[model samples]
Target: MTTGVTGRLGGIARHARPRGPIETLAEVSVSVESGLASDFRGAVKPGGRGRRQVSLIEAGDWAAAMAETGHSLPWWHRRANLLVEGLDLPKTPGTRLRIGQVVLEITQECDPCSRMEEVAEGLKAALTPDWRGGALARVIAGGVIAVGDTIEIIEG
Candidate 1:
């Protein structure tokens, strides 16, 4: 599967590169719901939310600055299954994405917290005064996602 953006969405292609070979496939998970800061509690499930999805700005138009930093830890440093390329998700909230069989709706932009600054070097300077970085998405549908799965914009 060609897992990246295509056409006008082709912007994602700019950041994609081959991952080479792997021994086994990885399982992908998404948070059913998410919120910013204090609101995050409400978004979590009874047990707990799973891995958060993220589109690393480094893979997209922001790569220049991100590369210079030599760090994936931006103000919003979170582990995401898919490191999206060529997409600034926080800037464009409400965007819909399809990854494998899962459909995700961008709910709101994820703001950075002091914790991110401590975890990632130079992150404090990378964030805005508000410390915003990327968008938080709600899983509209659930399914398995692999490294090569296509990420398409179903809606803007």
Candidate 2:
């Protein structure tokens, strides 16, 4: 059942640096409607209530990088379970992803906020304008997602 985007089980090795090709097929557990969900509340335009929700990045290093800067909150604040190596979640806004049986549509970039500043020192300054990290998506189809599940780019 392995395809270009979907594959079998994979291991996730922690990286000392935030940006780099770390590993492939690293499993990221996804949970619905969390802190990321709350942050997403402000990102959506008015009358876009159903368009906001946050899913956890499985092996995210963005949170890890923030931790290195002495931000403990950001370290534990990862809504994503796995931080993938090659995929840029934020860059693919409007794309569709299929993880296990769940289907998600990337809506917008998940920008860092003042709350991130409280977690990692100067994170607000770093993430401003460019928003160089993860993103927010809405679940079009709900299903259980776990580690080792396959992620497929159904539409781009």
In terms of TM-score, the best-performing candidate is 2
User: After superposition on all CA atoms, how large is the RMSD of candidate 2?
Assistant: 9.1
lDDT of 2 by residue, 12-33 (tens): 2222223322332233333344
TM-score of 2: 0.57
Model 2, position 51, has a per-residue lDDT of 47
Q: What is the lDDT of residue 137 in candidate 1?
A: 65
Model 1 TM-score relative to the real fold: 0.56
Q: Write the per-residue lDDT of candidate 1 for residues 66-141, one digit (tens) a residue.
A: 5545775332233222355544443455667786677776666555456545556655455433313455566667
User: TM-score for all predictions?
Assistant: 0.56, 0.57
Clashing pairs in 1: 3-149, 3-150, 59-86, 60-86, 112-131
